[model samples]
Every structure is written in structure tokens, then in C-alpha cells.
Target: MSVPTPRSPAAAPAPTSAAHRTLWRWHFYAGLFVMPFLIVLAITGTIYCFQPQIEPLLYPGLLRVTPQGEPLSPQTLLERARAAAPAGAVATTYTMRNDPRASAEFIFRLPSGNSESLYLDPYSGAVLGSLSVEDRFMKQVRLLHRALLVGKPGELLMELAGCWTLVMIATGLAMWWPRLRESGVRAFAMRPASGRRGRWKEIHLMLGASLAIGALAFVLSGLPWTAFWGKQFKAITTAANLGRPGDAGAGHTHAPVREGNHAAHGDHRRHGGTMESLPLSEVPWATGLTAVPVGTSASAGHAPIGLDRVVAIAGSRGAGAGCQVALPGTPDAVYSVSCFPSDPKAERTLHIDPHSGNIVRDIRYDDYGPVAKAVSYGTSLHMGRYFGLANQIACAAISLGLMALAITGFVMWIKRKPANALGAPSRPSSPPPMRAWIAGLAVLGAIFPLMGVTMLLVWLIDRLVDRAAGVPSRPVRQ
Candidate 1:
């Protein structure tokens, strides 16, 4: 489990520099574990980035519309979606789509525990199509990105992949480091090809070196979504009042913090309230924070104002065409108007009084604290939403570059590996370096829980294999 600290080449140990060989070994082993996942992630992430472009192409009949007239009212669309829903299922929030040709999308939680997404033509109110959210193509891709589609278990594996990717990147950088001092920073420059292996090696090094910073950005940005690490991060932000405006879990405080979804924010908003549970909707940050203000009268007998009226109210206040009006599922709940525009600066969240149709709470992007603003900006950039086509193109290019790097690295391994054994680097000539490496890994494992577990397992297996055979598992490369 020991790893070597990086060093320059000229003053380094001669033929078998343990630091160089050890780091190369780490780079090799980590790549063996991480290459397949990176390929899948890059491919899926590229697909996801172009979702605005690809979905219409894939499901044109269901997604696109004629835009012949003013589309049906929000209430009518919801009713149509409900009628179209499978028996014993209930429709929840309706996603306000940006495209005029696009159908109104409704989310339905089925009795079978799977969620179904219903798409309806806004003009005709006809059922366009229904897809199980979990089984849907993009959902499956997203699951593959987060986890290997195995739910919680898959999440751990994906997290492990992510952690080791860090290891891969670090060791890969170490391996590339000597090139900088020796060849005058030529790792970024592809040399003229000498042989097939040499050709792949140059290209691989150049690609890795060129995209290293960007790849690092991608990995760091994605860390906010890992189950354990993400939660811990969110907890810190919430506690510090650093991210997500008005997102305090202890209900409204002088400090506001926002979590990713309206549902979680709403649950936190109701931390100390006594009214019936509120329906989960994609709400803006404020509505989740704004409890029925001090004077919200109990107008129990007056049945809630219909969805159309609430939509009109939000429209008057500039809830853009892309904003959704979520009707309260509970008697006490208010209308939640939420919109997440391509520009993170345009995010808006509102809570509407159901009885009187007033905007009780309105939170805009400008209200976000410093940390929240940075996070939102970073998240938007990561999603390829910030610069329109330029953003999409850049994200796609990085993804393709990552896949290329993984492929070339794998090909290099195949070319070099001997027939009789796994072609890992030889053991370092010294053993003392390992204790420090193990300590560092322990810290990494603590931060990335699954990585810690995996490292322990791998360490134990390596130890047992070494003991049983009276030697190291792989051949000494010296």
C-alpha cells in the first residue's frame, strides 16, 4: 500500500528509481481499475451534456409539438397527465419545459415503487409517451455515472472509481513530472513517433498532460455528488451557512442555506412546524425557507385556489416561461414556483399563498451567499449550461479526450505486458516508504469511505499473497 513521493530525474536514483517505478506502478494499477469506468463515464457524460440536443432526436414524436396555439392551461395539462397515468398512480410535479414544441412533462410515482415520466402535447392534451424514470435511457446513464446502476451498492463502487481516479491522476502526473525537468516541459508536446509503442506513449502523455487540469476540475466538481462525501460536504455547508441561500435545516434562521432539491429544502423548512406535510416539488430556494409567515390565517374552509390562478400570479411576478407551478399536495402547503435557467444567475424560487395568491417568499440568485454563488456557478459550468454551445462543445471535447486517454493507456498496457504475469511494476527496493504511504491512504479512506475499505482489502490480499508464495505477487521488474 506504500506509494512514493515525486522527485526530479537527474539527481534521482539511477536505473530503478523506486519513487519513479513505485509511482508508475500506482499509475498502472489504478488505471487497470479505473479505465473502464472512465470510458463509461466519459461516454455517458458526453451523452448527458447534449441532452438538450439528443432527446428530441431520439423521441421526436413524443417531445416536439406544432405550437399551433396558446398551449393548454397548467391544470388541464395536469389532468390530462393524470388520466393518462397507469391505474393507482398519482401525478406529482410537472416540469416546465423550455421548448415550445416540447410536451408538458409530469412525474408520477407508481404503486410499484418506480417513478414514471409522462409526456403530453400541450396543444391537444394527447398522451405523447410514458417512460419509467429509473429505466429511462438518460436515467440509466445518470445511474451509471453516479453508481453502476446498483443503487446504494453501485454508488460505493462509483465512489471508489472516483477516488482511484484521483490516485491515477496523481501518479500519472508524477510519472510525467521527470519529463518536465529533463526534456524542458515537453510532456505537453507530442514528440515525433519512433515506434507503435512510442507513438502511443507520446500521444497518451500529451493528451493526459494537456487535459490534466480540466480532468482534475471534472473530478473535483463531481465530488460534490458522491453519497458519503457529498452529504458530508452539504452538512458542512449547511452548518457553516456557506452554500444554498436560506437553506437552514432548523427552519428559518438569520443564515440561509440551500440544498440541491426543493424536497430536501422543504423538509428542512418544516423542521419545527406543525401543519400537514407539504408536497415535494422543484421549488426555488426561498419558498422552502419561507414558512407561512407570521399572519398566514387558517382559511381551512376555502378550498385551495386552482393551479391556473397561481400560475397567473407567478407570471405577473416574472416567473419565466420555463418556471413550474407546483400545486400543494397538503391542505396547508402553498404553491411553489421554481425555475432553473441555463444561466445560474437567473435561478428563482417562490412560495405562493394558496388562499390569497400572494408571493409569500421570493428568493433570487442575487441573494445567494458567496459560497452558494461559487457552488452554483461551478455546478452550472460542470453541467455545460453556462455558455450555451461553447459550453457544450468544450464539455464534449473533454469527454472525448478522456476516453482517448483511457484507450491509449490500455493499449500501451497490452503492448507491454508479458504473457505469463500481470505486468505491474516491480516492488520498491525499500519497505520504509510504505508506512507513510499507508498513513496517507488511511486519511484518504477516511474521507472517501469506500476507498478506505477497498484499500484495506487490497492491502490484506497483497500481504497474504506475498506470504503464501514467499515472494511478491508479480515478477520483480528490475
Candidate 2:
């Protein structure tokens, strides 16, 4: 069989307006560039949203245990956990729950350069088995969601894609704007047609519009973690008069303590029937104090509080579900108990003196600043736990819609061919102005730092390519 010749350039049609052509060209190319990233994000996000339900099923043994005898003391559990680890490694124990049937977990770094986790019978202190962090389904899904199975660069790329997704949503809305007035319900509603092209277009427009808000929410919430948005958020929060002045050297600052009897003190020394407070700096051991262990304190010479006592104290103190009891790390360390009472709410961080088992400080959710509260809620929203079943269902719906949007977009792009090169018209054109294109690009770039940088890079590359192709440079309209 004879090989067919390629179509001649002369047979192609010319673009209506150079600017309209450029906008469409960029849209097509950018969509192509970000498609893989988009797919990864959608898949990972879908998996991550179901983690609360899926994780327990995947690691049932890791999450629970059968009652044996009286629960082991937190101190005893710590020692047992430490003994299980290799030399020089520190053990972190979580004091799980009061149900003798409930399991407690100890996490520690092994000499083999891997972290090891073990589930134990809280009552008998019997080690259940070692767990591999890598073997955890949720961990793997989270990694894929945040980093695309790669490291920092992948994370950055994902963030960039997230930013671009916002852009895509906006552009898509602009493209869909006409339908708002003309078609009403049919435009906003899903109405699949018989033709392949019609179905693809319908899918693209309807799904994109439906998920636009959700996609924007995810992007805006996630931006706080990106370098650019982190700084921007800091500035915005500062300017909004939300929190106290942040320390120049510190990423955060504590609200100044009120000048009443509740001021923070350094040491717990006994004075005239009261505690003799020292400057935080004057307390030599305070400098080394990090997270207090669940039931031990520095005042007690950093002796480990027995696991049983810690459990008793936590129960007595009404430590709610999802509470974590962290062990004191150093000589002056206090055991810290952190708990979240509800979804989309802040946590309570409580420090207790190990020796006396007295509560040192209690920081409730309401005590946190607005930004801190926002951060907590944003995290909950990201995890799809902000509102309960309704929120989770909404997230799942959005993820499915996003997947549909992306697939349909790709199909639509594939279905349409570029205009012919020799000034033929596929159809008569009503092209948008160059100024409109510039405004759209500027708005998109302003909202997404990565898009701004990418736009600059694209312009530079286009300049170089045109120069090499002996084509004259087109002046950007003022």
C-alpha cells in the first residue's frame, strides 16, 4: 500500500485574530501540560477523602486490641516500648483509650533508618506486632495526594497545578458565561446529547461549572502551605489585626499573657505557700524542655510516670476520643495531652506535671487566634471532616466532577483541529480583543504566582522560537 502524503500548509485556514488564536492556543497547550498533574491530584484526592473509613479496614490490627488484664501504666508502656527499640532511639507513646479492649501504639525510630510502630494491649502491656509506616494505606494515599509519589518538586508541581486549576476554572467560567443568561437550567444542568462532540462539550461545561467552587476552595485553602501564599497569608493576617505581632525571627508568636495572676512562669518552686516563679530563661532545664511525656515531669527528676497512672489521670481528666498523650522527652519535660473534641474545631493542648499529675496549662480551641482557627478548620475541610457526612459526600461529588471535567476537556481538545494555515475559515470568527486576552492573563497571573512565572517563561520561549523560525515579533498590545 502507498503511504499518504501529509496535508499542505497552504490548505489550512488563518486565525481570525492573532490574540484570540493566541488565547486558545495557550489554553489548549496549558491544559495538555497540566493534564497528568490534574489526573494525579484527582485520583489522590479521591483516595484521601475516604481515609477515615478506609484506614481502619486496611490496618484493623493496628487500630485495636482485645482486653487482657489491668491496663499497663503509661510509664511501664514507655519503658517496654523503649526496650523494644534499638539503642539511643526515643519512644513516643500514645495513651489511646480507657477501654481495656482498646489498643495503645508506640512509635519510634529504629537504627535501620526506618520508623517502627507497634500496637500493644493496654491492659497486659503485650506487644501485638510491629507496623511499617510504608505499609499504611492512608500514609501512601496522603503521600500521593500531597506529593504525587515524588518529593518536594512534586509537591511544588502539584501546588502549581492547583493554582492553574483555579485559572482553568475561571477561564472555563468566562467561556461559559453566555449560557447563564441565554439557556438558564439547561446550561447549569447536565444534559447529555446523542453526538460524541455534543456530549463531550456538555460534560466539560456542566461538570466544570459544578465543581468550580469546590476546586477553588481546595486551592485557596492549600495556598497557605505554599511559600508564596504562606508569606501572603502572614501579611494578610497581620494586617487584619487578628494576631499579636509575630516575632521577627519566629514564624509564629504567642499572644501576650494578661498581667493578672495567670502569667506564665518558669519554675515550679515552692515559696511562701505559693510557687516561686523564675524567668523562663533563668530555668536552665526549661531551655531543653520540649513536648512533655504523657505522665512524667521534670520536677520529678524526669522519671517516667507509670502507664497506668497516665491512663487513670487521662480518664479522670476526661480525655476525649482522638486524644494523644505525648511523653516527656527531657529532664524538665511535662506530659502533654492534646485532644480534638469535634471536627473542624481546634484542639486542646494540656500540659501536666508528671510527678504530681497536676494539670499545668490548658489551651482550649477558643483560646487560639483567628488565623489559627482558620488553619484548623481548613485542615478539617481538606480532610472532608469539617461538616460530617454531608461534607464528605460533597467532597466525593466534587472529585468525581473534576475527573469528568478533565476527561471531557481532553476529549474536546482532541476533537477540534487547529485552523488551516493558508487563510481558510472553518467558520466565521468573532475574535476577542488583544486587551481582553491581556486582562485575562493578568488576572490569572495575579491570582497564581506559578502561573505568572509560567506565563513569563512561555513568552520568553515563544520569543526564542519565533526568532529561530525567522518570524517577526508581534508587539504586545498596550
Q: What TM-score does model 1 achieve against the real structure? A: 0.81
lDDT of 2 by residue, 1-478 (tens): 9999998985644434454345544555566666777777777887888866776687677667776656666667777777766686666546456555467777765666566676776777777777765656666776787776678787778777777776566656765667777888678886657654777777777787777788888777766655455546555665674522332112222322222222122343311110002111011111112222232334545444555666666656556656766565555555566665445343545556556555555455555557756766775676577787677778777776777777877777655544542111121144346687678778878766677898789768755765576644232210
Query: In candidate 1, what are the lDDT values of residues 285-357, reduced to their tens digit?
Result: 2233334322123453445566778777766656776676555655556666677667777777766666655
Off by over 4 Å in 2: 1-26, 67-70, 86-88, 98-101, 190-196, 231-319, 340-342, 352-361, 417-447, 462-478
Off by over 4 Å in 1: 1-14, 83-87, 193-196, 246-301, 316-318, 367-369, 431-446, 456-460, 467-478
TM-score of 2: 0.74
Give the number of the best model, judged by lDDT: 1
How far out, in Å, is residue 68 in model 2? 5.7
- How well does candidate 2 match the true structure, expressed as C-alpha RMSD? 9.1
Report the number of clashing residue pairs per model: 7, 23
